[model samples]
Target: MVVIGSRTPTQIDQVPSAAQIVEGEQLREQTSTGVDLKTALGKLVPGLDFGPQGRTNAGQNMRGRSVQVLIDGVSMNNSRSLSRQFDSIDPFNIERVEVLSGASSLYGGGATGGIINIITKTGEAGGPSWESAAGVTTGFNNSNDFDHRVAQSASGGNDFVTGRIGVAYADNGRHYDAKGDEIFPDIAQSDLQGNRSIDILGNLTFRLSEEQTLDLKAQLYESGYEGDHGVYFPNLDSSTPNLEDAEIRKGFSADREPLTDRRMLNVNYHHANVFGQDLYLQAYHREEESSFHPFPYPDSDGSYYFTTSKQNTTLSGLKMLMSSDITGNVSLDYGVDIDREEFDATQMYFDDDTTDATGGLVHEEERVEPRYPGFQIDGLSAFVQSEWQPTDNWTFGAGIRRQHMDVAIDDFQPSGQSLAEGGKSDYDVTLYNVSALYDFENGHQAWTSYSEGFDLPDPSKYYGHPGQSVSDNPLDGIKTRQVELGWRYQGSRWLTQAAAYYSWSNTTIEPDDNLNIVQRDDKRRDYGLEASATRFLGDHWQFGGTLHALRSEQKIDGEWEKRGITVDPYPSQHTATLHAQWSDMTRSLRLQANRSWDYADYQGDEIEGNTTLDLIGSQRTDFGKISLGVENLTDEQYSTPWGQRAAGFYSPRFGPEYLYDYQGRGRTYTLSWSLEY
Candidate 1:
């Protein structure tokens, strides 16, 4: 979604100038590593890819595409774009993170490989206030392996009214790595940081007079882990045959439940002069769901045993925007979007496991009837952007958008499955953009951009098993094209920035697991290079870093090629991260280092790459803050090229193997304590 904003200001400086900002003191300085939001944007954004399990990052990817994930403006990329939506929320309830790269989304389908809003926590500034936080993380010779969290908040107001409320809880366990072993159990995105959570949110603002204002919000997040030590790896049955010696099991007859429950609600209306423009109205609703447990393979042979794969989405939207000033240089930003979605997608099978992988239990449970019918969407959009400045640092921008969609499906066949015929699909698209900005009196700033993006397919491939017809399916929509160049400099202690990009897309979908379906790859493409620098060595050292270099190709034979996992697996393409710090006003220290990118798997063999370290510390104690973190500070244990890429189950008796290549999180630690009352 793109915004020209009328309100909803979480200070990302109204992003634009291409985009990228992950502040809030860089996510409150990690606050003890596993506050998972895709592991705090894979340790502070840079392209993206997270898999080393601190629990779950779903199916990480960003650069290889599919990136949308918002909070505060709702939309956790549901009906496909699931990277489990980064576990819905929780990264100390963020307060910044705006990244927008590639097919620059300014309001169009789920931003193709870009857009991660996330802005939470709105409080403070005297008056009535309260905050209480807690933490206790583990892994370092496993102190009974742990993770415990707690949070509470409150805020008050005046000048009309204002409000805020918050709640949080966590209690994970078992994550030993760093040679302490015990991580095994990534049962397909079920690691849920060992699961157990609850989060709540609230906000209110009503200043209905002085130029108008009305805001209300609500959020709820739930996590799960109905247990029996979840752990699985059984998609096997291509005649086994070695299959990389597969074996890592658990829960063989019912005893797993990994879950995620998300909810959101919002209503906004603002005005600072509506007749002349500057009004913004919004209505939002979101309901995201996630579930897992695909265990099946315990003597009974060939796939069959307590299955459960759920996905449910429900997003409702309404946005009305306006911004003005169309003279003396021009300015405008317009918007209109109305969305509705409802997807079901389920796969549940349970005739009652016979309990076999140790956890003994033999019995009878029954209930089976879930043949994925999912799909029921409706969308409409409108956009207009214009910003021109005649002098003083020059600037120019242009925009266009028009999208429409309607898809309906749900017929589902049960009992003796087979025969099918359930369809309906529709789409119409047109998205565009342009940008340029210049400023230089020394503190340089330069910008350049071009964009387009779209996505339609993946409503679980529109009710599955379509065979053909449905307009040749591949309506997979998904179109993206982009180009970018950026430069920045902000002196005053030292600052630097750089950007380069190119993108191409039309079709891209993957999931063959030996012909289980979903396939389409009309040659994807990508180009990258990003850079950053910072320094202030004076009042106690400080340094900053970020460097990414990607290529992500895929056209095979006719040219291109270089896209592994047969063209897209997600993770690494020359990365680099480094940060250093030393504070004042109450002790603080930080350091992080990354250096990954050297991959070749899926026959090309050679999966070697390493370099990781992290450390953080803080103290402002007097009954207040105290923190410490250490994530993979040197216990490498490699794995990142799609983690171990061999390309999971290519079939025909183990032809292309590498079912979740495992191995990645070692060395970890966390400890925290907070307060603010």
Candidate 2:
């Protein structure tokens, strides 16, 4: 039964048995707020570590290896940074999220870790239907945010179409101190704090004939944030001015404005009886652009002091898949994929006082155009898999993939200087996986597997800077080795799962001293144990919990001074959450409570363990639905990966002397109402 809910294997034949489908509904519920997918998943899945930090996206660590994310079966992780955000997709549009907990190279290079697939909504064969809903909420810290959404779908004859569009806007007020009297510093002032987003989605499907069908999909997303940097400054003269007044005098010095826009288009066709087997073909293109302007200031001389940067990315790919039943007890699946990606970036520096130091201000303006340049990457992969049921209680699966990658910088220049006269690199990778599933007589199952994964060097990493030492000598690709064993039991109202895994990676890529280029040659290993359980407490109550214990270590092969320079970015051990939900006889009213714990061992040297609690009550009626909730009931002080100490560094450094703060939101409450049609 669990296999039915497990992630669909890319090779089709290497499907999971009964122990891999653990977090589905829980993932959807945790991500309802448009938070980063990794953060949401971390709350439910054991052995997963994720939080907001270095970049806007969530960083993920699964089974001691990095994890890659895919939206609608398309890779979303930026090849250069390995960071991506899932906020662009509306939660309402997701059909499901499938997490494959181990290394997988069959999908393509770049997945030296695990993989997550986000499946989008698709029209089903039926009639026409329309749905719409809207909600508004006001919470503690004077927080007020509202969300409205509407969707319509229909299927007639042999054609089907569906469209969904939504917009969400929030203006979260400043948070107060522990005593609930003073406002926290670094937070945006009451006048400057707010965030807004817009999302649009469309999909159309046409049945060309009995053996062929066509599908088209497109999506657009835009979001912006206006807020102060999460930092507090001591008053210049504490004795002369009050903290509030002193902050006001500073004129909201710490502020950031960021804007992001993204679009995706896809066209796919599926046909059966093509070349005597079921065939699938798809074409997809995605474009994303983002800009950030921090601390924009209008100077006295009609000039502005600002720092702005823009990034643009484009991706296109085509894939073909075929499957056939070779025998009564055996099946085969094969596929080929070709993908290309390009990225371009620009950063500008301007100064208001263009003239030399003097009383007169010069009108001449100078501009510095530092081009990030652009590059192209081509990937080709072919894979074959077989599933064989040799016995009544056992099943065996094996798959192999041969992949080739070609990367080149297209007219790449660093500050207008040529790099390697346009460089290119090619690599070949071979990956194999073997798995077995055994079902006992009592509805219990066990599984064991071994798999390999790899990631090629991205073009950006090789061509970003010219004449840079390490940039001149590109490193080889990265690779991972993984082995896992797990067991599962499912009863009428109770479910339990447990697993243990060990993973090792070679030539890990990491930022060097320059921070402009990355160097490879680091080795790392991760081993962990994880368990989860969900059970019914009563006729109307259900509870669930997940726990994890992990150890990760890294070693850089260099001089003694640098040999131990290892950083464990993920929590070593943690108990994610405990949640319970109950409903009264009326079925119209419901209550829910959740508590999460991060143990001391889970926190880095600079971080401390903290507990968070949330409560919610909802009521439904003919007119609409209403819900009230409170979060951070204890108002605990904590910091996440997003906390920072250095002025230009986005990542927070852990340690007592670092003087870093997490700046978590204090106690907050919310009241929401929804109208449905």
lDDT of 2 at 370: 43
Error of 2 at 586 (Å): 6.3
All candidates' lDDT scores?
0.66, 0.54
Instruction: Write model 1 residue lDDT over 360-449, tens digit each, in one string.
Output: 222133554654666777888888878787887777778888888887766666566563455787778888888787877587778887
Q: What is the TM-score of each candidate against the true structure?
A: 0.35, 0.80
> Can you write out model 2's per-residue Cα lDDT over 381-464, one digit (the tens) per residue?
898877787776677878888888776665555454555345676778888888887767475768888888876655565555
C-alpha displacement of 45 in model 2, angstroms? 2.6
Worst 10 residues of 1 by lDDT: 4-13
* Candidate 2 global Cα RMSD: 6.4
